[model samples]
Structures are given as structure tokens and as C-alpha cells.
Target: MTPRATTLADVDRGALREEAERALRALVGREDAVLREDQWVAVEALVADRRRALVVQRTGWGKSAVYFVATALLRAGAGGGEPSGPTVIVSPLLALMRNQVAAAARAGIRAETINSANVTEWDAVHERVAAGEVDVLLVSPERLNNPSFRDTVLPRLAADAGLVVIDEAHCISDWGHDFRPDYRRIRTLLADLPAGIPVLATTATANARVTGDVAEQLAVRGAPVDGTDGATASALEDVLVLRGPLDRESLHLTVARLPDTSAQLAWLAHNLPRIDGSGIVYCLTVAAAQQVTEHLRASGLDVRAYTGQTDPTEREAAEADLLANRVKALVATSALGMGFDKGDLAFVVHLGAPASPIAYYQQVGRAGRATDHAEVVLLPGREDRAIWDYFASMAFPPAQEVRATLAALEAHGTLSTAALETHVSLRRNRLELMLKVLDVDGAVRRVTGGWQSTGEPWEYDAERYERVAAARAAEQESMVEYVRGETCRMAFLRRALDDPELTGPDGAAWRCGRCDVCGGASAGVAPDEAEVEAARERLAVPGVEVEPRKMWPSGMAALGVELSGRIAPGVQASSGRAVARLDGIGWGGLLRDLFAAPGGGGADLGPDGDPGPRDEGLPVPLRRPVVEVLDAWHPEPAPAGVVLVESATRPTLVRHLAEGVARHLGVPVVGVVRPVDGVPPGRHDVNSAQRLAGVARRLELDLSPAAAAGLPGRAVLLVDDRTDSGWTLTVAARLLREAGAEAVHPFVLAVG
Candidate 1:
């Protein structure tokens, strides 16, 4: 019986046929003539639906071909409509961008990447984009964030943007296997644009979170499929997450710790067949990559190092060599795997444990690109755990420290980084990271001056940070447990690690079954178990309590205050935006200048309205003089002089007098208050009083006391380091009057 396919009138069969033919022709021209049946069906469905689609196929599933071929047809006017200006592809890596550009050119499509690693001239590219001369624009997230690019080119493209394709769309989610912070902002960028541009988010792998986040980021509802008028995923096979036996062939899984590069090189030399293919050797740091590259070169292996600092041209050349089979191995630090697709890798050696299992999976996934038997060698040493911990530590600040910082800001209103150090004692790097987290979490808001508690002062919740930290910790522990599980390693892995792809009943056939502990072989598991337990115990010691410490400049204690208590300075306090304010003292003008002046020897009063400056620079606070009173047995010059004192105490008053005598000679000063608790008072005499009173006028010294005993023996004097406030002198004078001292006068070192 012949089956007749029902063709709906609304479905543009002519357009679909034209587009399909155009794409087929382009593919044939590019020497990629073979198209799987599913690929054809997917293309037909997408053309009929008139919606962007996601291709969720595995690494080698011809995913890129689906999009490129479809693009070619659309650009060739096969869909019975004029194509948009260009197809905008937002790739995650520079190498991927380059490859796609080259692929497009080969297929007779005008495509170019906008990313410039090192270019003195970007004007031509920007102008081309603005003029809509290019068929496609490939850019990185960072490049997209450029205001110039966004303002100059993106708006023009938005109007007729054919499709916005995100290659590594899993990066949209933090829970994605390969997450990047910049990737999270793409949704916002697109949402702000003018046009209702169709977005095509594609990735080789996606967990539930990644899938959901990608859909959400692209503004898709329900499944990211055709019916939603958004995207339809090609018929992708269920992800084959293979978990195999811990055997000699599965050299990567057998290690408790990744071995050094030297050991890995030797292992590779011993086991790997030189089949004119290249491999990647991943390390935790650039130094490790360099070290491996040096040794590998010494061993006559074609090797190179790729790091963050690697030159772009050199990096491209090295990758070209690897792809061309001119190099056997490339030692790198997370740089080689994501963007470059060298189809014939024989091995991937991880020199240390990645910070997370997903990272490990991503790194290992670089190998076995072909259907051939390839190995992912994890040469973990005893130090690998520590290295992983170090990585995590760098990624996330101590949650407790973050919590403490939040609490301090809430309670104190605002804090400079210096004051924050005292409250939440953390190293400079850790503190910066914590502050950033706090800013991101919105528990604290970083204004120009410092971090202000956004919520209430008592809000010290680090629940989310702690939860993430704990989840990551559990994940790491699970990996360690996998390494030491006593059961059949393959079974343990498949059951525990959620690897569903190893379908055969006898998993041995899928991977190495002759592991040391498997097949009646001894792996010395007991010793390893002990070592694991010891390591766990060591890390289990409750992390040190995170608390903020109040720190102050040195020599502050000499002024009768603790080093930690005096003007907590770094940037500026959150509250009180003023040059300086002191009342009742004649030196108010001077005090203002002392505190408000900007240059050295003056406090940074900060702009009047803006919150004080942030403590990013860790400025030094100016030290002001202290007021010390001395006992001269001076009698009252005025019948009702105010008494001014540091602490309203006899000793401080006496010290103030001695210090003021030479500085404030002939200042008419009187102390009213006497010592409490029967403390000895300053000597009372007419000559001392007259001399103090006369000099007090020049220095503006004041004294006041409510009673004879409370009076500073009419011998009170006012002195302060800087005159940020006239209040010190004024306050001292009032106190002297209350202490029964006569005319109160004031004296200060310098006025604001």
C-alpha cells in the first residue's frame, strides 16, 4: 500500500522545497553531501514552523550542520521572502567563532566574527555591522557588553536580525555544566533590544537546569519546542552518560589523585598509539601546563601550552597544528577544550582534579570525540584534592565571613574596607570577594562610599551562599566516595553518578573490567580508604568562626583610646555627610578646615551629598592632636565658668591643664567639675587661675563644674588635636561652668 502524506494548504510547501534545495546545494558544494534522514525531517519541520530551534544532539551529531545548512537556504531566498540583514551568532569562544566563520564562507555565505583579541582597528568591522554589509556577526558576551558596539551596531541589526544563535547556551544557568557569569547577562541584553528577534540557543549537552534556564533566558514558555513559537529541538538521542569500570584502560577513573604531567606523559607514551592525532593535557594552572609542555617537548612530543596569557596568534597556530595533526598534545588550562574542536583526539590527561565534577566531565569529554577507543587519563596526585579545594576557595569566599560583613554593615550603617577588616577579619583577596558577593546578593548595597546594609541591621543571613557552598562540598565528597567505593566500580558509578548510557547488562564490555579491585585483583583499597577518612577528618574540623574585627590606626591608644576605637577610617563613614561640625568652640572654622581639607594632613571630607568614597584605595586617616589636662592648682577666674574635660574626670582635666599651660598661656579658662570617686583634684590657686584664665582667651580653653568637688578646681583647659568640630571646646567649656568654674575658654590645635 502506498501512503499519501497530507499536505496542508497553509504550509508553504513551495517555500520549504526551495529552502531545502538551496541548503542541500550549499552542503553539496561544501563537500558535505551526506544528510541524515532525521536532519532533513528537522529542517522541513523548522521551515514549516517558521521558528528558531535548538539542536540538542551530542558532540559529534552534526549539530552545527543543521543550523548552517538551514541558514544557507534562508539567506539564498528559498523561503519565498527576502532574508534579514544578517544572522547574528553569539558564540561562547573565539575559536568557535573563527571556525563557524570559516565554515560559513566555505558554504558561500558572507560570515564574519566581530570579536577582536588584538586589533588596533575595529572601525571597519563596526562600520560594516552598522551598514548591514555582513551576513552574520559572531561576538562574545564581553564584546556584546561594549556600549559602543551595542549603541552603534546592535540596534541596526535588531531591526532585521535573521536569528540570534547562542552556541554554548548552557552557560545561561549557574547549574549548567559549563557556566559563565557573562553568559547570564545575555537574556537581559536581548530583552532590552527593540526587535522581537528570534533566538536560537544551542548546546551539545544540557541537564534539566540548563535546558530550563536556556528556555527562560530566550523568553520561551513550556518546552523549548516548535509549538511555543520559539524553538524546536532536533531529534536528539537521549544523552549517553557512560560510566565504565575502573580498569587499566580506564586509567583516568582509577586514580585517587591525578598524577603529575611527567607521569602522565610516560603513561601516554607507553599506552597511546601515535595514529597521527593530537590530544589535550589539562592542568589546574598555567605553570603546570608550561612545565608539561617543556617536558613533552624534551621527550620529542609536539607540545604547546595554552593559558590566559597565551598570545592569540601563537594560540591559533598551536591549535591549527593540533587540528592538522602536526602536534600530538597541547598542555592547557581550561582554554583548549571549550572552543576548539580537534576531531581526532586520542587522549585527554587531567593533571589535577577540576573544581567540580561537571568541570571534570567537560574536560574528559574533550577526548573520545570519535567512535574510536580513546582514554581520559585522570592523573590525580595526593595534592589534587587540595588543589580542587583551592580552586573552590578562590571561587567562593568564606560564607561565614560574608555573613559577618553583612551583619557589621547592618549594625554600623556603613563601613570602609578598613573598618570592615576589623569587623570581618579576612585577607584582602577574601574580603574583596566577600564584598562582591554581598553586593550581588543585595543584602548590602555598595554606594560610592562603602557598602550600606540594604536590609535591617540584624539581617545576617548567608543561607543561599552557605547552601551553595554545602552543595558543592557534597558534590566533591561524592566524587571522592566514587573513587573509594568498595563495590564493583562500574556498578557503583552507574548507580551513584547517574550515568544512564552504559546500557549493557555486562558493563565490562563497555569499559575496562580488569581494575585492580575488580576481577579478583588487589587495589590496596584499605589504605586508600584510611587515607580518604583521614582527609575527610582533617577538613571536618569546623571552619574557623568568621567574625569582623574593629581595627584602628597605630598610636591611637596614646590618646587615651584603644587603637581599634578611634575614627574608624578607610574610605568614609556611611552616615554624617559633612565637612566637620563642632559647636560652642571659637575654633569652628579652623576645625572644619582640619577635617574637610582634601590634601595630605587633612581628612577626606568627601563630597557633600554623595555617600563617602568607597574604600577601594584604603586611604590613611589623618591623626589629630589630643586634649590632655594638667593640674596647676588654678582657682576660678569666673564665678560660673564652664568645665571642659576629656572624660569629665580629675586626672584627664589635670593633664589637660599641664598640656594647655605652655600652649594657651594667658587663656581665661576655668573648670567647674571636680573628680568623682574621691579622685584627687587639680591644685587650686589665684595665680594659677589668673594665668590660666589669661592664656585661655588666646587658646579658647573652657572649664565648668556643677559643684566645688566636681569642679576641675577652676583649672580646666580645652585642647583637641584637630578642629573638625568646635564642639569639643564648647562642650568642655559648658562642663567647666557646670563644675562651678568661672569664665570658660577654649583652645585647639587646628580648626576644621
Candidate 2:
């Protein structure tokens, strides 16, 4: 039986809106479910008017509902005979995609997602989408640029897609707090889209500037002229923007000024149970998240660590644990930030401040979403700025490096990322990010085999990049101000996001009357003395395993280095230990300060002609950790001597550290590997291949009679100030093994 259908000309506007409301009610499984006026306006614009729109609303504002409702109404042929094509949503995170799929299922809308994790199912998914069996298709921005998808799938999808949705739209703007280079590919998708196909871009954290940028991209050029207008006109200025106040009334913001990392961990251990329900404890780095997770677990609290390093299955498990309230918290990095849905999350605590106020706002927005009151606390650490500086250093490689990458691609015709790495000095992550940016700018194209330059006249745009960098630095300063400012905490955040509602009729910032400063809430609440002491002990206990590099980096020969394949098992350095990662909690701050540049008051090398003085020794706190590591190592054939990797930059510190370890282990001082003939000082900034080549050419073992006679047939403790690529340790260990040492156990003050 053919279903009754009405054409667009015969459609009743009032009946269409009523049908949309019914869809919303079915979506939420509640008869009382009704769309907000703004949400309805967005839905009407998309389904009724077939116009593009941008929604910049706060978290929990039902931005998803706007798209889902529109998808249902359009797919059901609101005023037509046949079902419309599927809605393609460009989402960012897998967790978010999963949530959307489930939500759509509840609304009787069939949804499917294509992402890296489900590569094996892509063919089936594509078939379903092609056959119109799928009503909604979710894909990550990165997937859009995939060779197969871009060449074979995207054309059909874009041509027939009923609506194109870009979630986390802030990522499209370079000025956004979490700008993703791949998100820029959406502009290409938008441009290729057929006219009259409405597009919806949504984000919870875009400020006015980001809103304008996103809206401009959504605008359609040379759009078909409507008959009513009787003239052809572009749709560039027709983007409907719906922005709401960036305020979370349920959140009670506060800052707890702890003396150190130990105190902060102690406070969390003491206060987590007191919070209303399960939540997240955010850390600025993966190492810190692991550290916090371990400490909390030791305190008998249920917690898990979530970071980029975690396995896919484990991350999913962790998310499930949080959603089911099976765990107290998930100590996580920014990997868990966007689109995680937990309506009843009651609290959010930060071990360290994020680099920008915008990022902080988005992270904290996850809590107090469904509850009347949720605690949001910030434990600002002194080391936050240094971490920020480290990340900032990786932003859009210098013009020279970018040009080198482009030139390499042009010269080679097609080169993979690994092949390109040998031609450029940027590391893997930075190189990939740079390539994505260039790809979006039309300067290069990624093919099946690799990337190829398009010969487009691309400018480095140094001035624009510099402006962005300056803006980032200013944001970091604003974050610091937010932490230490005397103004109302919520008000300060709202003002930072440029929330119009923050200003009253008189044009003055309005106090939220909910934060610590405005509400007179005490920030000293903490765990009991016993728990604090336990947490202190757990944090103070330091030692991180430094896994030895077993495999040589590929493409060494291409870089003119004659090494390849896995390092010989017998020559590999045994598993190593460090006091801590330079970015971790506990002793990380001290190590960071210790290794700081000379201009920052850190130790400096002696005058050029010498190996530097050895009077300066290890600091007292570091001394105990080194001894603890040595005692815990307990090598099978106990070490017989200690050998130091001479540091051109901090000779005195490395010498003392090696000597202290030897004394504690009662092992004799073997000899040091000194820099040979004037091979310029090794650079710590280059790639593994370059660093290995430099170290190989520069460092040589001191083959003195004492060293040769004392080293054979016994394990030796190889000590260094730090280990980055482990190439230095690999070379040193191989040399020692060849010199008759049975094994070398590497130790370091810190590991990158």
C-alpha cells in the first residue's frame, strides 16, 4: 500500500512543526519532551526552509536534538512521497558517535558510523548507507580525508546527503582552543554539496570569533535562486546563527590552592567520595593521569586512567565504567574531553589547569549537567605554564620546515609520512599535523601511496600564525588570571567566552552568585589526616620504568645511517628506571627545574675547553630516589660497576648522579663515555635517526685499562641525566656489550 504523501507546495507549516515536536517526544521517550524555541527555529530552518545554520549553544542544550529531529522529519518525507537521503554527521570522537547512534536508535532512526576502530565493517556500513538502509552516518573528520573514502565514497554521499552536520564545529577554526587541522576539510565537503541540501554546524564552546568563522564556511556560493525572490543570489549571508549564553548554573566553581602535587592528590582522595556521584578527574598530561589513577586506587577508591596511550577496548571499558557509575572516577587527559555524555556526573576536578580558559570551560561543562549542584574544582599547579610552553613549541612548524616538507613531496612525487620524515626534521605528530594543514590549504594531496604536492602557490602566512600564537599566549595568561583572580569565578569564565548575558542592562559584568568567591564557600575541605598521609606517601614513592627501545627506527638507511631492523637481543639495554617522567607529578617538577635552560638559573656546562667541574652533586630528594631504584633493580648477576654517559650540557649533575648510585650500590666507578674529536655537541631536538647519527659520530667509550679490566663479564649501571629517543642509551649499551660487559642496566634522572 502506498503511503499518503503531500508535496512541499501543499504542506501545512503548523502540521510540520507539530510532527517535529512528536519526533522529539519519541526521541527522549517522554511525552513531555518539547523543543526549546531556539532548537525549534533551527529545526524549522533546516527541514522547512532547507537553509544552512550554525548552533553555538552550551553543553546539555540539545544541539544533537536539532539535527536528529530534522533527520527524522526529512527522512520521513515531511511533505513529500519518498524518503530523503541519509544525514551525514562529521563528529570528532568515537564515544560521541556511539552516544549519537544509540540516541538515534531510540528515536527509531537507523544510524551507522565509519571510524578507524571499525575498519573491518566499513564495506557493510557503506552498503547500508548506499542502499538507504541507514538514516544517519557518523564519521570522524580524519576519515573524510581517507584516500578511498574521498575518491570513491564522498562524491555519492555529498551529492545525495539530505543534511550535512558538523559537530564540534569549533575545530574548524584555527583560533579555537582545540583546533583540528582535518576539520578544515569540511569546507571542501560543503563546497561540493548540492544546492538546497541544508547543513547544520554545532558546538558547545565556540566564542563569537569561532562562530563567524564556522558560519562563513557553511555559507553556500552560487546557490539556486528561490522562485519567490525572482532573482539569482548567493547564500553566503543567509546562515542562521543561534548562540546562547555560555553559563552552567549547576556548576559551583572553586580553586583549591594546595602546596604541591602530593597535597592535591591527598585532597582528591579525601574529597572524591564526598562529591555527589561518579565524575572525572582531569589531568593535563597522560603521565599525571596515570599517577593520579594509581594514587586513588591505592586509597581504596575505584578509578581508571584514560589517555591516548590506552588501548581502544580499555578506553571503551573505562567510559562504560563511568557511565554505569561502576567506578568513582576516570583520571583522564584531554582524550576524554569532548562529547562525553553523562547526565548525572556530579563533580569534576582538575589536577592542573588547562592552557586556555575556553578549554577549561568545555571540560568543566561535562559535570552538573543533569544534577542541581555539581562541584567543579581546579587545583592549579605551578608547573602548568611550563607544560603549556612545551605544547606551544609544537604549533605549526616553522616556515622553513613546512617548505622543506612541501619541496620533498614535490621532488619525490609521492612519499609516505615515514619517508617524508627523513626529508624533514619535524617529529611524527607535528609532521602529520602540518601535512593535514597543507592538505586543507590545497598545497598538497594525499593519494593511495602517499602525499603529492599540488604546486599551488601557498604562503606560510607567518603573520597570521604569529597572531594566533600571540592569542594563545594571551589565553594562557588569562587562564592564570582565572585561577588567581579575585572576581567571581563563574563571571570571569563567562566574560572570557564573551557571553553577552554576562553583562547587565547597565553594561557591567554580573556576578553568578554560585562560585566560591561569590557564595563564600570554603575551599579547604580535604581528606582526613590518615588519608592525606597515605596519599603523600604514595605520591612521594617514585620510580617509573623506562622501556628500552628494542627496534631501530625505520628508514635509517634513507637518512644515510647504516642501521635497520630490531636491535640484537644480547646488545639491547635491560629495562631501565627513572625518578619520574619530566611531565609527571611528584618529582617531575624538580627534574623539570633541574633540566631547565641555563638562562632559567639551571646548571650550565663548564667553559668550552674542559669536561666541566664535578663538585655539584645530585639534590637530596633525587638522591634517595636513585638509591631506591638501585636497591629495587636487583639484577640477576648483580651489577659490578657504574658507567656514566657524559653530558656536555650538565656534566657536573650527571657525574654526581652516577657517583651517588655507585656508592649506594657498593659498585666500583667504571669509566665515562666522553665526546670524541670535535663533533659538535649533540642536539636534543632532532629526530631519532639524526640524533643517533650525531651520537654515533661524537661519543666514544673511554677504553682505559681500568674501565676494560673492571667491566667484563658483569652487569654495569649506565647512568644519564635523561633519555629521550633512547638512541644514546642504545648505542652506549651496544658498545659496552661489545666491550665484554654481560649486561647494561640503564638508569636516568628523568625520561621524556
Candidate 3:
């Protein structure tokens, strides 16, 4: 791929470019009513800066104009056309990219967009990128996550890129409503770029903490312009917000009880008149959604349902209908959030409680985008609240319970909740609840037996008095903080939420003054200093202190042990030191500190680095004297095979030895173990005999019936992962001789 620089003459810049510049300069120099004074100031801030600093302006504050001015400066021939790297803009949403691209095309700028939607042929895209035909490549983070895309396109962009723009930059923070795991990796992506690459992060909503987080995530210095909250409030005036009368509306909450979809269908039929505009009925499950769609269609209400079960094509069609006003209503599961832009929605009805508060807010926000008044109806039931409560539990776990669970695990090697509750003198149900919370934090993953730590857990003591008090306070405050105000309810909401829209007297008023509690079309009366101070004092109570913990894995001892001897077996041994070396000198001190129980015996000198307790524990098999050469061995074929048997008291031992030799030589090994005194010859325990035979089958060796054998001192090796004593190896080798071999040798992985 070759890089090409685009000349000013290459794009449509005849008279349109001049007109755009004129229009832009007129607004820049003088305050125009259409362009707010603050908006112009924001544009100047971006244009005036030599280095990039983020403009954390509110939504609908003419943020696009700031970029326009910057683009014009970069291209106005003040600095000659970019020699290499094109100015790159990294947008979070494809729609935002499309919007920005359309706006730029109108202004006569030579801009282009390359994202997953386009650029199907990656190699061709790279070629064009290197050629430098594109002035701006609008991309989503998802496209960048592709390894091929990163390896190919990013490098070329990095080489000549001047500016990188990130829209909705709040998503980069954990606190963002939508937290993408991969989004966290973008910090590294930005940092690893060429030194001169400057990042621009813009978001509609950001609190102080989120602003700081965005700056750190992007690795940039930020310059925040004040009054953004007011700007957003002004934009909301143009948006209609209708609040339904609490008692007058014909709204009765109905829940889909009884896995029966009949009740829900009947309710939708009864409420057809209320759902006048394009409506949405949210379902909790895909099966429910499907049933509702089927039953609703039978009753004749242009309904379509979407869930994860729907194919991509079906989902896209459903979304297109909703957006194009073709479908009357959409009955959907929670999979309908991202990139949904249906603005003129009249009603949104919740069939079930949503997964989380954030989800509920986002879904509700989708409606009444253009209208002055929008209605949202929530239907609550035991099932709905149960699902909601489950999520809430995961989101905000009881700190006392989490701390107790973690402490129990730390004290005991590993504790089951059943056992831990007994040990802690608590109920099993309560303990289970706490463990579930830890599970949600990604601190642990549930296993069949118990939980395994996935990452470091947040250190929290749910039982501390301070923590309990804080939780109680936060719970109470969420319910009682907002009341009727003289001004519009939206203003009170902005004040309560501390959104970027609570600034200035003009911005303090809602567009529609009839918002329920605030029935007046003006700003509410300002709170006196005394009331304000009291509110502040109440809010100042500190939140609970969070402590982090890491889940640790145990159970290494139960994986079975390895045995080895001085002699080399058929297998090769590397030059690394044995486990015993790590144990004798370095391990004891380490184990004492880590586990608080010191092993003082020879077993403590067992395998190097092995964490086995040294006192009164059964000696691990790996510490035995004989190095058992047990491997997935395949023996070679020979004219005569050797019989190998130690003095095997058990036929199982004899069969094991036979199988090992059989595999090594790729021939059947005959077993010949002498019967115990006065024992019936062929009446061995059939169950145990059958089990030994099964071992032979697994090793790909054929076991022979008892046969007379004789052979000694030729050359052969016995292998096993474990060896307790020398007697088994001795009898096994004797049996190998009785069958017909020249020699028998014994080996094991370890000697204890």
C-alpha cells in the first residue's frame, strides 16, 4: 500500500468551501443568536490551543463546530497540506461517525470514514491508508480491537496522524453506564502511538470524577469549559417531556405471572387505546418475547419482537422499521439499546423490570426524543422485582458479608459456604448471599465444588459500623432527596442529578413547564442558603471504605505426585533441579511465612517448592525410594518378550507392570506372579482382576493368562509415577522372567 497526500484541488471546494469559511468566521468573530456565546468560546479554545486539551462540553452545545474550526485551521494553507499522517478521528458510535462525516461533506472538507461497516477488504483499506487518500478515518473501538486491523491500518495512521478524536469518551471509564472490557485496553493503544499524536475526548455527560477518569484513560490534559450543564438544559427545552397523571391515566400495572403468556396478551389487548404512538413492550425473556409477538399478531397489532435469539438480519429489519416508523410497536428484550435512534416514540411500557437501573434509564431515554411529553409505564411483579433485586444485589453487595466470606477463605485453606457458615456461626442462606456478591465483582468464578478467584477482589468489610451506616444513608437519600419545586421538574432533576444542565437562570427552566410536580413554565425558586447548607451537610457523609482482596487457588497436593530415581528411564530428564532442592533450603521458610504451619520432618525436604505440610501428613508418593518410570509408553515387538513382575501381592500391580513393558516393546507382556500360599490358583477377586485387565486395555497392551516365564538381567526398565517400596518392583520383575524375557529393570519417577 502506498501513501498519497490529498491536495486541496482534489475535493469539492469550489464556492462551497468559501461559503462555509465565511459563515464560520462571521459566527466566530461576532456573537450570533444561533450559535451560543459559550459555543463560540469552546470553538476558540480548541482553535487557540497549540496542543490539544479536551473540551468537556455538554451535548447539543455545538461541539461539532469546535472540530470544524480546528479542521479549517489545519487545512486553510496556514500550515501547508499535511505531508503524511491524515487527521484521524476515533468515534465510539457508527451513527456519530456518519453524522460527523455528513456535516464535514457539507462544509467542503475532504473527509472519509472507514469502519467495520465499510473497508471489507482489509488489505485494500491498508493500501489506501498508506496512500493517504483519507483525511479522516472515522472508526469505532470495536474495529480497532481486530488484530489484523490494528497491525495493518493503525500503524499507517499513527505514522501521519495529527489528531485522534474520541466521542462519548465517558465509556472509557468503569463508571460509564456501558463498560466494555476491551475499552480499558484503549489506554495502552493511545499511549503506544507516536509521541506527537494528540487525543481529543468529548462526552455529553461527565461528572468531575468521570472527567478526571477520561483524561487519565486517554492520557491527556483536559480543559473543561464551565456552564456545560446549562447548555444541555437549553437543548432539553427543545425536547418534549410529558409526565402522565399519577391517578388520572388509564394505566394499571399488569405482570406476566404463571409461565403462561395469556395474561400478558390479554393486558396488551385491553390497553391498545393507551398505546397510541409507536410503542415498545419490553420482555424479560426471549421465549416470552416470542410468545407475545405471536399472540399479539394473532390479535392484529403490527408487532415485532427482538432478542438475542433473533438472527442479525431479523434484528436489523426490526430496528429499521422502528426507526422508519413502519412498525407500530416493537416488543423487544434488553438487546435493543445500542445504536437505536427512534425519536418520536409516544409510549414505552415495561413488561418486566429491566436488568439494572442504568439499563432502565437508557431504555426510557429512548422514548420522547422529539416530543414535548412522553409517557413511561412500569409494570412491577414479584418476578420482575426478583430479577431487578438480583442484579441490585450483584451491583451493590453487602460489604459485611463479602468481608466475612473472604476472611473465611483466608483462614481455612478453602471453605465451603455450608462449612463456613457453621464455622462463623451464621445461617447458610446469609453466607450464600455474600458469596454471590463476590461472584458479581469478578473477584471469583463459581465452580462445581466452590468459587475460584478470577481477579483481585475489592477489599470491603460489610460488617463495619461505618460501612453499614453509609449503606443505610445512601438507601434513604435516594428516596427522599427530591420533592415538588416551584420551577419545572426537569430543573429540579438537573439539580438533583448534578447533570451538566443545572446552570444559569435561563437554563434552569424546563422547556415544557407542565412536568408533573413543576406545573409552571419557569425556573423554580432558588433554595435559601440555610436549606442548601443542610442539603450539603447531609450529602457530605462519607461512603464506605472499600478494601480489595485477591482470590487464591489451592488443591495442588491432590493432583497426584511424581517419583524419580538416580537411574535414567526410557524418558529423558532435563537439567532443571528437582522439587526436593526447592524444599530443603528455600521452601521451609517460605511455607512458614505463607501458611504459618512449618513442616520439620524429612517430608518437608520432599519435592522442591512443594507446599505439602511437613508434619503428621501421609508421606507423598513422590518421596518414595524407587523412581517409577510410568509414562504413556509403547513397547517394541520382539521374537521373545520378557516377563516383568515385582513380588506383586495384588494382580493389579502385576498387570500394571506387564502393560508398561508391553507398551515399551509394542508387544504383549506376559505376567507371571506366584500365588500366595494356599490361595486358590485361578479364583482371584474377579472384580479386581477385571479392573487390572481394563488398565491393560487403556495402555494398548494385551494381558496374557498366567504363564510360566523365565528371564533375567538383559535390559528393560520399569516406570511408574509413584513407588512406595522396592517389593512391588521386585515381584513384578520376577513375573516378567517367568513369562520368557532375557532381562528386567525397574524405574520410577521418584524415590521417597
For each candidate, C-alpha RMSD in Å?
22.7, 11.1, 22.9
Mind giving the per-residue lDDT tens digits that candidate 2 earns over 270-333? 8888876899999998888877876787688988888876544456667878999999999999
Q: Considering lDDT, where higher is better, how would the candidates rank from best to worst?
A: 2, 1, 3
Best-to-worst order by TM-score is 2, 1, 3
TM-score per candidate: 0.54, 0.73, 0.45
Task: Please report the candidate that would top lDDT against the real structure.
Answer: 2
Q: Mark the regions of model 2 whose C-alpha exceeds 4 Å error after superposition.
A: 1-10, 220-234, 504-509, 524-536, 545-752
* Clash totals in order: 104, 0, 78
- Candidate 3: where is the Cα deviation over 4 Å? 1-34, 47-119, 193-198, 219-296, 306-315, 332-339, 342-363, 367-385, 388-493, 500-512, 518-752
Q: What is the lDDT of candidate 1?
A: 0.50
What tens digits encode model 1's per-residue C-alpha lDDT throughout 203-280?
655644455556655653234335443323431221111112212233233442323334444544443344335688
Pick by TM-score: 2 or 3, better one: 2
Steric clash count of candidate 3: 78
**lDDT scores of the candidates, listed in order:** 0.50, 0.82, 0.45
Higher-scoring candidate on TM-score, 1 or 2:
2
Task: Using TM-score, give the best candidate's number.
Answer: 2
Superposed by TM-score, candidate 3 places the C-alpha of residue 658 at a distance from the truth, in angstroms, of 52
